[model samples]
Target: MGIKSALSRPLAAYVVHRDRQWQREPVAAQLRLLRRLAATGAPTAFGRAHDLGALRTPADLARLVPVRDYEGLKPYFDRTQAGEADVLWPGRPLYLAKTSGTTSGTKYIPITRASIGNHINGARDALLHYVHATGRSRFLDGKLMFLSGSPVLEQHHGLATGRLSGIANHHVPAYLRRNQLPSYAANIIEDWEAKLDRIVEETLPEDLTLISGIPPWVQMYFDKLLQLTGRPIKDIFPNLNLFVYGGVNFAPYRAKLFESIGRPIDSIELFPASEGFLAFQDEPGNPGLLLLLNSGIFFEFVPAERFFEANPPRLTIADVELDRQYAVVLTSNAGLWGYSLGDTVRFVGLAPPRVVVTGRLKHFLSAFGEHVIGEEVEGALREAMTQFPAVEVVELTVAPRVSADPGQPSRHEWLVEFARPPADAAAFAGALDGALRRRNTYYDDLRRGNILVPLLLTPLPAGAFQRHMKRLGKLGGQNKVPRLSNDRALAEGLVENP
Candidate 1:
């Protein structure tokens, strides 16, 4: 056996136990998680106020703590940030992860020691799952380039605060850190453009086996590497066998990323957020990510269609039905109590409980009463891209455009920046529109009614969104272009860029 495989036996063993229990008694696992949380967090003000100590069942816990968003929990989070002890978790957070959003601005998410450990353990379990499925550990002996944010964190009242990737980078095991790409000095560069430049310089010659990052940013790196080496990534890094990605749907970039790499390699999808490590893709063939029921995060699901309703019903893992969309509400060891992560997901597997992240709850275009989600839009775009074999969509976003004149009907406006421009941009947009109409009945009805005008497609100049993000100081890390927006500000801003 390989040394890495031998050392990972315990983790592999835990995966076996966890997967068996997940398949057999997922509900029991969730109950045990809640009970454990009640014990650990019982002393905190949030726990005491919610009567978490006395809670003996999931139903009891749910009834006591109302589902809350970041704004709802901001007060307690503020106190915790101000050095208060046990305001939410057992004590003060080990660090704060700054999660940036267009609507909510920046949110400081607490990360306790236990929560950080769970994040690390989740990453380990992801690899262990891969090893178990494929019986391959040769990649373990080679280097891993984590194309993440700057690791040098800023101090906030004696507590480190930075991006989630940066926070996790601080806790990366020394053994793996030895193989992680980009020198410490290169990684600490705050400017993403500068960091990418330095990363290319430092790791271009390394024998990298694994690469992990958000898809768009990694695409940028791949493009840049191709520009520098005049060779495909597979040729440059011959041993590069695995690609781990998250923070956006990989569908649109699948073809483009493959083209840049010049070949297919193993890929894993992770559904991690600053709030918690939620799920990760377990099966190579299956696109669905397996929810981590025992990973220090208690989950509740509120149907996405009814999320805005007053007192929307929150269902636990045991009650979630397959193929139904739900907004994820999580109570984690990270001090977030009954917090809604704002991401929507649909369960594909009930036995072991697997889910596919659909979209963000707030990030939908429903101006004309035809609600179009990120998943639907992305899927439509992917289908359309299949027709234009030569074109590659680099970045895109959509917003509603209500006519200024009274007689005009409203329509959807798409701003797309392509790496390889389509021969016929109008034809491409038409295909995308037709695909959306087929996928969303509401959208199709509105179009057929002439209440909404034909979808308008505007080809944005390359790097437009990247430039906008850079201006917003959100050019990299977990920050991504919001796929769908109600307001035209973000899309228009990118369009307005000369």
Candidate 2:
């Protein structure tokens, strides 16, 4: 065995053991972390303004600081960007993770020195947990490709600013540096298509074992590799075994990804954001991710249904109930107070605080009073894919289409990009529509009442989603097409009629 593989087993055991200490006492750990964050933020401008020093409990936090999204907190973020020390956190952030925002345009989220470890350790612990569970760490000896943003940072008012993935690239552990692939030059290529070509050239001859990225981009990489080598990914990289992915649900892409590889492989899901590394899949075959309670962040759950209410109840770890959907609010060491992460989650396990991300709070379909979430659409698509084994989807998005003509009925339109088009397209649509109706009572009611006709399925031309993303200048690097939108904006841009 290689030295790294041999050492990994003991390290995995130690990491898992250390993890369980907090896992077993989630509420206590979270409470302690919350108190610590409050105490740490006590001296900051935001802390003083929000009375952070007086916060003794989650209720105090909720009452004192209203939950704010990026726009709400932009002033504080701007102050930090202007090089104001201790405005939000203890000092100017170590780096600003620049991310695309809808309303706010470019967002610079603070990543403080103290909180950066959470991001790094969360990823490390995920791998260690896999190693601990499977006792198969040989992949560490081979080249590991992390398909990520350019690691190039630009100065933004004295703070080093870059994409979160790019910022993360700088912090990859020294031990894994030798095994990391595609080189720094390939990573910094600004144009994604050009970058993919460079990456393929660099890694094609190497012994690549593990590949990690957001799903769609990974799929794009797999496609490129197959195109270049004219071989299934399994044949190309015989040692390739694990896929680490985050940012989207993998179910819709699983069949296509495995088909591209010519075999099934182990995969890990992570719940990470600019704000914090919230959770990771701790066990194989479990859909729920274990929420990191002691990761320099304190979490609050507000019922997603009542999230827009002026005074929604913010429940802490001890108060959250299993199976209920909640909007995640957080107070972190980076000095975000009562910040809404915008993602909705459902708790599946209370003991270790395992959660499944349902969808974005703002990224749902409610155009016709039928509130269908990301989970429902993904579940429906997964069910349809299972039933139609031959149908392999590349990408898909849904949007509600309201007919201007009174005689015509309004309907949800699904624009699907297929790797292998279903032999019976109508049947596939029926299966998808049925699955959705089964999951959502409002959708079922609308269907039965004929207020909305059966969903319209539009088979998009090959690379339709990619073309649209390219047009929008979001073709790669942590960008993803929303599963469903309330209006026809994304759908209209994605494809022409028929």
**Leading candidate by TM-score:** 2
Off by over 4 Å in 2: none
Model 2 lDDT per residue over 1-498, tens place: 799999999999999999899988888898888889888898999989989999988778888899999999999998998878999889789999999887988988999999999999999999999999998899999999999999999999998999999999999989899999879999999999999999999988999999999999999999999888799999999999999999999998999899999999999999999999999999999999999988898999999999999888999989999988899998898878889999999999988889999999989999999999999999999899899888899999999988878798899999899999999999999999999999999999999998999999999988888888998899888998899898788888876532
TM-score of 1: 0.96
Model 1 is weakest, by summed lDDT over 10 consecutive residues, at 1-10
lDDT of 1 by residue, 1-498 (tens): 556657766667678667776668889889888889888888889888988889888788778988888989888987887878989988788988887754567888889988997787777778888877877767877788898888778888778999888888877777777777877899899889999999999888798989999899999899889989899999999989898998899988888898999998899999989888899888887988989888889899999999889888889987899988899999888988889899999899987899999999989999888889999999899888888888888889999998868687688998888889889888998999999999899999999988887799988887888889999888977788889988888977887773
Clash count list over all predictions: 0, 0
For every model shown, what is its TM-score relative to the native structure?
Answer: 0.96, 0.99
Poorest 10 consecutive residues by lDDT, candidate 2: 489-498
